[model samples]
Target: MQTSDFLAELSQLTMGFTPVVDPIYGAEVYRFLDLSTSNTIIDSVDTSSAEAIAVYIDTYLSKTGGKVAYGGYLEKRSIYDRSLYFGTQEIQLKRNIHLGIDIWCPSGTAVLAPVKGRVHSFKDNKNHGDYGPCIVLEHTIKGDSFYTLYGHLSRASISELEIGQEFNAGETIAYLGEPEENGDYAPHLHFQIIKDLQQNEGDYPGVSSLGNLSFYKENCPDPDILLKIESKVKG
Candidate 1:
């Protein structure tokens, strides 16, 4: 696609989240990520406060309101997964880093469509530290075709999503996968944008080595460009 066409297409599909509460809790944090990070990928997360994180996830998922937190991409990483776990330099030297944007929310939280698209694939990646249940959608904005991956969702999220099923913009496509089904972490949405899937579906390595950074950089654009959240930094 031409550069101008791509930009125009991007503008069309980019949709904002309909906040579920009167005072959205994380809008400022989402803004911070957008403004502070040029690349749009978040890394170096501290997961030590597991209890606090779990509570946050529960709150979002338990809501009955139609509104949901708006963000571009959802993501998670594992301290047990050697490739992403932070550890001694010796261990980190051999493994890849975390990649993709995480939409931290509660389990059962409804993950809606930012734009119209077709179901690409679904998978039950049942490993303990893997994306337990996942879905991918292929969309054409303007004239360019691209894909978005929704990872770490409840098993039921993918149970009824048939390949090629058409979903309209703002439709509720899937609910947030619970922690048990979502690769054993606190519930959240792992959203990623892919220019080319390279024949992979239902799952993709959001992270890549520093050596292959250029490849991921070009293929995966920052999702927040579409989400439009303002950013603020805190110490």
Candidate 2:
């Protein structure tokens, strides 16, 4: 199959990268949650508090029989209701489609950069159910420019970072933030591949409403294209 020049470059870039978590590339099983399905547990999730979110994820992990829960790219989630920041009041179409891949794991788990890149921006989006502490890295692979966004990260992740600091592949760029500091939700890293920043700084939309799904999906392709963990997902 023929691939685009951009994707071809991305493919080359990922060849030497490591798993975001050691377990995903090892013997441990990882569950893929299809939040887009009608029977998903997302309907029952109570986002009232940080502890509640932890319990919800724990129960899900147990049910799926995996230490790590992955999936969520382009998946519609009802849990976004917890935050009014998602969409404009007049839009009616709420932003529930997740634009990034989420890795649900215990707090303090290390997060690795999948490629060599320079930090473009970093900020603490301090809203309930927001990205909390986030970092966006800019990269140029074979002349094709792109960006990687690491959201819901520990405050310490960007505490010492500068705008243009560089990171090599497989380097521990950050740790999974605790719920208290990670948008008041379960500990997870929201990893996204963005084709453009649209002039946004320190943050980008990780979710889009139904009306905007096509546009967002195009700008942010499936992260698995770079993650390359399709077989690791539990059947």
lDDT top scorer: 2
Query: Per-residue CA lDDT of candidate 2, range 132-216, in tens?
Result: 9999999886666689998888899889999888888888888889888988888888999999899888899998888888788
Model 2 error, position 80 (Å):
0.4
Give residue 46's lDDT in candidate 2 (0 to 100): 60
Deviation of model 1 at 33, angstroms: 7.7
CA lDDT of each prediction against the hidden true structure: 0.60, 0.79
- Taking all chains together, each candidate's TM-score versus the true structure is 0.70, 0.89
Candidate 1 lDDT over 1-235, as tens digits, reads 7545665567556545322222234444332222122333223333334354465434444553312333423222334343233233344332234455666665777777666789988898876656789888999865667887878888887877799999877687888777667877666676777778889879886655455566776677766555444332121
TM-score of 1: 0.70
Lowest summed lDDT over 10 consecutive residues: which window, candidate 1?
29-38
What's the true lDDT of residue 195 in model 1? 78
Residue 71, candidate 1: Cα error in Å is 8.3
**TM-score (C-alpha) between model 2 and the true structure:** 0.89
